[model samples]
Target: MTTLTIRRPDDWHVHFRDGAVLEAVLPHTSKDFGRAIVMPNLVPPVVTTADAEAYRRRILSALPDGHDFRPLMTLYLTETTDADDVEKGFRDGLISAVKLYPAGATTNSQSGVRDVARVYPVLERMAEIGLPLCVHGEVTDPDIDIFDREAVFIERVLAPVRQRFPALRIVMEHVTTKDGVDYVRSQAENTAATITVHHLIINRNAILAGGIRPHYYCLPVAKRESHRLALVEAATSGDARFFLGTDSAPHPTHLKEAACGCAGVFSSINAMACLAEVFEAAGAMDRLEGFTSLNGPAFYRMEPNTAEVTLVRRPEPVAYPATVPFDGGAITVFDPIFPIHWECVPAR
Candidate 1:
């Protein structure tokens, strides 16, 4: 098809960091996505409703003029996270979900809960209140292979939680392996998964192939090709349980190009364009709306956007910058490794 239009989409996962970083990247997302489940793993992390509220204001302040984006804030779940505060945030509409980072699963996760049992009370309360727990879904044990963490997390941690609180809604964020997809399918009733544009497009080879391309690196890091195919199947299947969450995390280019690089893919700038190319490759263009716009709000128990966004395939490839400026510096944009012909905008 030359053109496609769907409800303005929401990103169930995103990280618009604080300060200058947040300001530089907020527009990339706000330009197209109607709303996003803003991640709370900043330096201090948003551990309370007040923190989320303050952060939300900062996000609003940074948004470009005429942009109608809403940041759906989240609390970084911790052993000390107050169940009452969590429930209050959910009820008051200040927070969309609570994130469990597994104490070193990803960036700024040192304060994450180390022991799942320590937060059983909080988990039980969330289940009771129907608040969804968005998990990073990777075990950070020193002995486990990096590639095996997500699978191990499913077997060791997530499975028990599922059994204990069958009613709790859970979203396995940026799922990178087939194991994750299978587990989510198994829970069919109250479980779902968010796939990233980076994961759907690249594999470990993109990072370590000809050389160590640090920009391609990310947490739960990209897995093998078979796993990528599995994610593609889940996303393009039009399954309600599978939806879009770009996980469009941005780390400064200096940090990413360092000896010990950070983990994230800054795709907010080109997410819809990349997703259009991905869905087109799968020959599941018809299901793109279900993955990007429809399923996420359904899982979040919110209404689909009243507005629509249109993406048109241009005759020539759309030109996108290699880097987006930030202060005097810049962060490299994600290279989709494919020609991008689609340009997304509000559907008039």
Candidate 2:
């Protein structure tokens, strides 16, 4: 129980911004995860096969020397997305999935789809090619309360899409509510979800309570403790439909501390340590591999990693860096506010 070796995990969701931010945070994830599904919501967004291929090159080029990391690229779904281009990227192995942002659902998502029906052609093609569509399941309606968006998204958006494309694979990215968990479970096939490390640990109080802590703020913001417990239970339950996706987004300290702060949690640096503690405390340490490493590949229909990484539980808490500095600014790391004893032994 003190030392666990499992196939290196893959992050089902991550945002590696271009240039300095990309260089700064890419290694934090690459060091621990064998691969990650790179989100395409950049300033301009990656909507074409050519954009994905170019972004892939930037990720590989920014990858630290000696670190073996594969960036599973995805296309940002827009109303005008070409089915031919999407299929071409999926067929050529350049794109692992397509992303649905739901127009203004989160950061850098103004270019997202305003009307779901406008993208039915692209969704139909994706289902035919067997490509998974990763969704940021939330509504952008100004009337909907922030806490209620995810649940409403299910009732109003995702359910309708499912009825239209039953066979299309879908991943509800960074799910934060009990409703989300129930919906993912309701689907018998072609559906799964990615749970973020922050959601399993923090709640709305983390942001609204004790003044306003911008660092803890994220879109589809963390819900109440009841929902947190639901996410914890779902993640620890060892379900194939549920797996790890850190959603390890990085934003500069200045932007995060501003009047209008950004929405993201940078947890890539110590995500494994956090997950190890969360799973261990739940008395489900044995199922860690299934949640972190095994189930993800099964859902993605790929082979688990051939390489192994060992996490050893030390006698005392390990201190992870508080901030990582890039060229223009520094990005803060997520603090789980719990003891972290697990450390990955460096590969030889």
Candidate 3:
């Protein structure tokens, strides 16, 4: 139990923002994950096959030497997205999935789909081609309570889409609530969910308890302690429908600590360590591989990595870097509010 080795995991969801930020953070993820589904919500966004191709090139160029990592590109779903282009990208193996962000749902999401109905044509084509749709899983209604968005989104938006296109593969990204867990469980085999490392550790208390802690704030924001417990149970339960998607978004410390702070948690640096701590505490360390490595590929119809990573439980706590510097400012790393004794041993 002190030393454990498993297939190198893939981050089913991640945001590698372009330029210096991308270069600064890409190494943290590539160090452990073999592949990552790169989010397309850049300043202009990656909406076409060409855009994805160009971005992929940038990611590969920024990758540190000797790191064997692949960026699984995706198209940002917009009302005017072309189905022909989408299918071509999927067929050519340039694109892995299409992201659906409800307009204004999160950072850089203004160009997202405003009306879900407008993108039905694209969804229909994706269903036909067996391409997966990764969703933010929260409604953007002004009247709806912020904490209630995910559950309400299921009842209002996602449920109808599921009913309309039963064959469309959907990944409920960052399932933060018990309601979300139950919904993903209730669906047919076509449905699965990605659980983030931060959600499993922190709840709303981490954000609004004593004072405003911006680093803990993220869209589809953390919910009650009960919801956190539900997510922990689901992740540790060894369910194939649930797997890792760090959503390890990096925001510069200046922006993150601003008046209206950005929503993201940069956990790529210590994600594996954090996960290992959770699993070991739950007495479910054996199931950690399923949550981190196996289930995601099974759901996406991709093969699990043959390479192995070993984590060793150290007598002293692992000290991950506090900040990663970029050109202008530094990005903060996620702190689990706990000491992590497990560290992933580097490949020799």
Candidate of highest lDDT: 3
Model 3 scores a C-alpha lDDT of 0.95
Clashing pairs in 3: none
User: With candidate 3 superimposed using the best TM-score fit, by how many Å does residue 138's alpha carbon deviate from the native?
Assistant: 0.7
lDDT of 2 at 57: 97
Off by over 4 Å in 2: none
lDDT of 3 at 310: 93
Full-model lDDT, candidate 1: 0.93
List model 3 lDDT by residue over 1-348, tens digit each: 889999999999999999999999999999999999999999999999999999999999999999999999999999999999999999999999999999999999999988899999999999999999999999999999999999999999899999999999999999999999999999987999999999999999999989999999998899999999999999999989999999999999999999999999999999999999999999999999999999999998999998989988999998889999999899999999999898987644
Clashing pairs in 1: none
Local distance difference test values of all predictions, in order: 0.93, 0.93, 0.95
In what order do the candidates fall by lDDT, top score first? Answer: 3, 1, 2
Candidate 2: deviation at residue 91, Å?
0.8
Better of 2 and 3 by TM-score: 3
Q: After superposition, how far is residue 286 of candidate 3 from its true place, in Å?
A: 0.4
